[model samples]
Target chain A: SQTIHQWPATLVQPVGSPLSLECTVEGTSNPNLYWYRQAAGRGLQLLFYSIGIDQISSEVPQNLSASRPQDRQFILSSKKLLLSDSGFYLCAWRNGGILGDIQYFGAGTRLSVL
Target chain B: AQTVTQSQPEMSVQEAETVTLSCTYDTSESDYYLFWYKQPPSRQMILVIRQEAYKQQNATENRFSVNFQKAAKSFSLKISDSQLGDAAMYFCAYRSTFGNEKLTFGTGTRLTIIP
Candidate 1:
């Protein structure tokens, strides 16, 4: 069985503060990782995705960035947070190769930027 | 790029009754995948059902099923014997079968089950 862990479950950060969110997957190797954000009443938006270590693709231009340090470890970071950066962050992992469409999501982090 | 559309912003169904949620998508590819995800107040997204474009027979999981019309680009979810536990925000998503791993999601429809 594959499991994804994300933390801290909830975060409260002041403006211009640094942000770091970590996601790690156990029981799977070389899995594709993704970062998504959901606003209060809006749909989720894809922020970043990585095919392999050190290879990341960003969907939108924002203050947030993502990195894949290991095969199953992904991190989302920001040098300076903005008020608009507040939202629910989700980490997902998918099987690699052909036919890896279904994604398994982790418990999201509730980030409140005051 | 694939795009999913769930027009209904919100829907309500009485317990033990049936309800259908509408979903439409646009894509140039012949084969792809469609899915329904449920997000409760707890904010965890869970997969309810999935449909592959190549399969003509609709996929069913227990009380949940899909009416997939490939030509019409419509994939609707039918929940039989709906319960209060079924109340959640349902999201429709599309994924390319050709190789794209990214899933394009719809705005979602908030389903409220009345007691």
Candidate 2:
């Protein structure tokens, strides 16, 4: 069985501070990783997705960025955080195989920017 | 471009009763996938059901099913004998099989189960 892990479960960062959220998957290789953000009462918005180690796609233009350092390790980072950047961050992973289309999500990280 | 629409922002139903949540999508591609995801108070997304465009018959899980109308471009989820655990934010998503794997998600419908 494959599982995804994301941390820290809760984060409080000051404005203009750096941000780093990590997500990793076990029991699968070369999986598709994605980053999504959900505001207080708003729906989730896709921020970034990566098909491979060097292939990353951005769905929205924002202060956040994503990277795939390893086959199953993905990281979301920001040089300087904004007040608008505060939200619930979710990390998802889907199988890269031909018959895999279902996406599995992690516990998520709650970031409160002050 | 593909888009998913969940018109209802919130819905409530009494426990043990049935309730239906509607979802509509727009896509030019013929082969694709539609899914219903449940985000409970815990905030973890759980897959409820899935439907493939090629299948004519509707898809059903234990207590959850989807009414898939390809021609109508509609996919609605029906929950039978709703329980308190059914209360959550339901999201509809779409993904094309033509090499584009990014999922386009709807805003979501918050379902509240009354005791």
Candidate 3:
């Protein structure tokens, strides 16, 4: 079985502080990783996705960036956070080799930028 | 680029009744995928059902099923014998077979089940 782990469950960071959130997958390799953000009452928006290590694609111009250091380890980072950077962040992994595999989501982190 | 739309922002349904949520999408591709995801208070996304545009038959999963209209570009979800646990924000998503394979989601419909 494949599972995704993302942490910390909740975060409170002051404005202009650096941020780092990590996500890892177990039981799979060469998986496609994605980062999504959901506002208070809006739908989720795609942030970044990586098909392989060092092959990251940004969906929109944003304050954060994503990196896949390892096949199963992905990190979301920001040099200086802003008040608008606060939201629910989700990490998802998909079986790239499978035909109809669904993206599995993590527990998500509730980021509150103070 | 693909787009998904969920018209109803909020809905309430009585227990054990049937409720259908409407979804429409825009895409130029012939073959693609559609999905319904549920997010509860925990905010974890759960896949309810999925449909392939190439298939003519509708897709069903337990009490959840989808009415897929490929020509009309409409995909609606029907929940039978709704349970209290069904109360959540239901999101309709679309995925392309090509491109980066990212899911394009709609503004979700918040379903409230009346116990």
Q: Pick the candidate with the highest DockQ.
A: 3
Q: lDDT by residue for model 3 over B38-96, one digit each (tens)?
A: 99999988899999889999999999999999999999999999999999999999988
DockQ, cand. 2:
0.63
User: After TM-score superposition, what is the CA distance of residue B26 in candidate 2 from its true location, in Å?
Assistant: 1.2
lDDT of 1 by residue, B40-84 (tens): 998988999999999999999999999999999999999999999
Model 1 stretches astray by more than 4 angstroms: none
Q: Give the Å error, residue A7, model 1.
A: 0.6
Q: Which ten residues in a row have the lowest lDDT in candidate 3 chain B?
A: B94-103
| Interface RMSD of predicted model 3 | 1.1
DockQ of 3: 0.70
TM-score for chain B considered on its own, for each of the candidates: 0.98, 0.98, 0.98
Interface RMSD of each: 1.2, 1.6, 1.1
Instruction: Go through the candidates in order and give each one's C-alpha lDDT.
Output: 0.93, 0.93, 0.93
Candidate 2 Cα misplacement greater than 4 A, ranges: none
TM-score of chain B of 3: 0.98
